[model samples]
Target: MIETSEQGDVAVLTMSRGPVNALDLELLTAFPGALSDVAGAAAVVLTGAGRCFSAGVDLKRIVDGGPSYVAEFLPALSTAMLALFDHPRPVVAAVNGHALAGGCVLAAACDVRVMSGGTIGVTELAAGVPFPTVPMEIMRHAAGSAVDRLVLTAEKLPREEAYRIGLVDELTDDLVPAALARANALAAAPAEVYALAKQQLRAPAHERIAARRERDDPGVAELWSASATQERLRGFLSRLAAR
Candidate 1:
């Protein structure tokens, strides 16, 4: 589910799945550990192995597990995202292709993101699912007014649109190379100072995330477990397969 390589002080972590990289339990379980192991690297670049970056969670898992699956699934994934957000060094998403659903959330959680013009952002909220609040917090912090339109509607913002919305930090045809170069630059900075600066940078968002967790997570979790969400998911999956 992951491929790791060290380039000087930078660690490149690639999501390994053919075509569109979909997140399954295997990915959720493996990614956090892989990220933890590479914590020593001054910077980390997250990309994909094939044509696309990641398409988000596996539909098969959701179909089999039902609505409760989201409650269980999101918390675990959130733990991973939290680790990335709190990691000492910079993390960048190298968006080689489409970044949809949880994939978009993952990209947004990173310190910076670089995308090719063809990449996409799909939240799938009309399918009756929502991203973890932590990632929403990141989006709210990073994109400001852009978050209102993006998150509220759960629209799929294409690469250029995303760039205009400030969801992506940079745009390039050679995403991987550009992201790697930025990672190298970050890695070259003093580690202690970088860590402190990043911590300070994320502090406000972290605080808001914490507050949202205490105030709203149970309701959100309940929404995930609701019968309405299950019905919607079932219909959505059927439609997806049909297409």
Candidate 2:
């Protein structure tokens, strides 16, 4: 479930999907609507329930549900990512712990990212999953050119390194408190002005990737459901099971 609370002008959205807060079909489907509901808040703080922020999508679910699941899941995932990226309000990520794959993309999509513990990374390639164009664009915008290397290598960076590479905007010992403070500060700006400025800053990314998202998303989903990708997933699952 997604939990919401108001801290002064700052609204908080907590990912409470349990344990690792895996971004499964349900969470992906509900995420955008949840954010839309809190759009009226001056600023938003997004975080997870426990130690870890999110472990990304549940590969097992895709493996079990097969092609139909991949088709629906891919679009939902893309929509949720785009929602966070395009949200008019200043959205901050209180990254309390490890945020891998889709989770990392979520943090990157936010206007500001404040991380406290664990690590953050794009592990799509490592897991033998293909990256859709939208996520690649989001990460590139967040972390700059270094993002290309990380995506290719699946290197999980510690908080210091993440901050260094611009994957996170700030790092502090207290995640929520720091993020809430940042959100409160940003909320002080005039609503329309801030929204417009934020949108302007994000336009380049949106414009550049417009055609690609329309093309890549469905294609990647089909690729994920392909026999070869399934074989790779089987190997990935086997490694997970062994662990």
Candidate 3:
């Protein structure tokens, strides 16, 4: 699910699930471990194989597996996301293509996001699911004023618009090189100091997540498992297939 390679001092982790690299339970469960595998690198560059960074949660899996699967999946999703968010080393997102819903949240959790050609946004509402506390907090921290439109409208903004809205730190066609350069630049700082400063900057969001996750996550999972939500997701899948 993840392919790890070394590019000089930077660890490059590529999501290789293929097609759109949708986040399923297996992929989510493997992600944190992949991060652990690269702990020795000075920095990390995360991207996806083929044309997509990720297309977000495997809603088809959710619709097919029902509530039991949802109960198991949500926790894994949170774990993977938090692992990236709290990684001690700098992490850069090399968003090569579509990053929607959970995929957008994953990119948002990174230290710097460099994009080439991609559309990015959160479309959880359109899927008839509410954001889990972790994703909500990350989006709040990254998107600022753009969060409302992203969450509520569920529009996938093109690369230029995404850059304008501050969703991506840099826009360049030389994705991996630009992302590697930025990651290296950030890694130049004292590792311990950089990690500590990052933790401090993200402390507010972390605190909010710690405070509300226990209460909020279960409700979010329950909603995702609700029959109406499943039906909506099925409809969404159909629409996607039609397209």
Best by lDDT: 3
TM-score of every candidate relative to the true structure = 0.92, 0.96, 0.98
Q: After superposition, how far is residue 11 of candidate 2 from its true place, in Å?
A: 0.9
Positional deviation of 104 in candidate 2, in angstroms?
0.1
Off by over 4 Å in 2: none
The TM-score, computed over Cα atoms with residue i paired to residue i, of candidate 2 is 0.96
Give the winner by TM-score: 1 or 3.
3
Clashes of each: 0, 0, 0
Best by TM-score: 3
Every candidate's lDDT: 0.79, 0.89, 0.93
The TM-score of predicted model 1 comes to: 0.92
Show where candidate 1 strays beyond 4 Å: none
| Candidate 2 C-alpha lDDT tens digits along 1-243 | 899999987889999987989988899888889998998899999999998899888888888889998988888888889988888888999999999999999999998999999889999999888988888889888888788788999998999998887778898998789999999889888989999998888788888789688777777878899988888888998998899
Expressed as tens digits, the lDDT of each residue in 31-143 for candidate 1 is: 77898899888799998888778887776677677656765777777776777677788899999888877788778878888998555665667677765678678667767
